[model samples]
Target chain A: SQQGEEDPQALSIQEGENATMNCSYKTSINNLQWYRQNSGRGLVHLILIRSNEREKHSGRLRVTLDTSKKSSSLLITASRAADTASYFCATEHDTSGSRLTFGEGTQLTVNP
Target chain B: DAGITQSPRYKITETGRQVTLMCHQTWSHSYMFWYRQDLGHGLRLIYYSAAADITDKGEVPDGYVVSRSKTENFPLTLESATRSQTSVYFCASSETGNTIYFGEGSWLTVV
Candidate 1:
């Protein structure tokens, strides 16, 4: 079963606009990471927010984790056309072994 | 240097034939993973290995087999390829449990 579920199945916005995607999980997690996948390509790691941390940033990507609500969000500021891709959230549980459960993902299109 | 590489890049095989997808990483990451991407299913984990000689099944592990004989190599094999197994397969590796690096992916088509 999928531990994470991303909201807003798809989104379309202008190149300069911002795109925000949300993810919700069911159980406790050690960390939540976001990944971007271009069409017909593999996933690229974006940012990871640990359970103890509230927010983290990498370049124009911002990730926030709220353990209390079991939810996390990824925000891409001033989105570019190249940033158009599918984004997914993966949850790493605090278990003995490391196994990541991923969400369905959100497809974002940055229109020029 | 290739961080991680997967081959044959693209493959086409007949149903009931066995096919193996190979993944190799240069970082010697302790953990490796195999995932399949479908139209609506997103990325589903098929199998993962913590280290050499250790492997475990993931959510969609059925119909798939994996082995991590070495820290840098993890291979996924479909015992009997089926049309449902036709999808893009991605392999990922991580030094630890937190961050993962992925390969370019292998496109497999079972006819």
Candidate 2:
């Protein structure tokens, strides 16, 4: 119920399994981005999906956006133990100027 | 060195002290931002600047201050640090509508 809200606050799965994270927003956005953070370090950009785009993929990552629903999902295929990290979804809404609002994030654990 | 860098990577200060965190970027991107990361809250934007001398507040800008005197430097200051302000601060920059990059982070503690 916020600008960017991600669910499944914590997730654990076996290596090679698929990990999916979902995000929802309350307003129209220009673009939505996914970021990964390991431990407590800085965040690393993973991918970005524009409001007009419905699906995008990069290597093992896949992101889908549905503007009508104002929601997005990120899927990591064949997950690896090194993929363990917190994933966050951020949105740059139409009225947010040049900044983005981030959600609480999903802590993913890939057990090898 | 190349990307974004934050100074005073770790800091400890009293409750009422004024603390400033310095941010510098080498890419000279036009958009810069300050965000505070907490345990349950994730990353909350504090301040941002589109260009020099033009700054705006973000989602949580209560006690934080920001000024972009130059294109490469954006600094955030806590006028009066509070225990609630103790969190990891991150500085980021991007070319308008592009991928944003983040600094390592500044771990601050207020006692």
- DockQ leader: 1
Poorest 10 consecutive residues of model 2 chain A by lDDT?
A: A92-101
RMSD in order of candidates: 1.2, 1.2
lDDT of each: 0.90, 0.92
Worst 10 contiguous positions by lDDT, candidate 1 chain A: A93-102
Clashes of each: 0, 0
RMSD of 1: 1.2
Q: Give the TM-score of candidate 2.
A: 0.96
lDDT of 2 by residue, B77-110 (tens): 9999999999999999997666889999999999
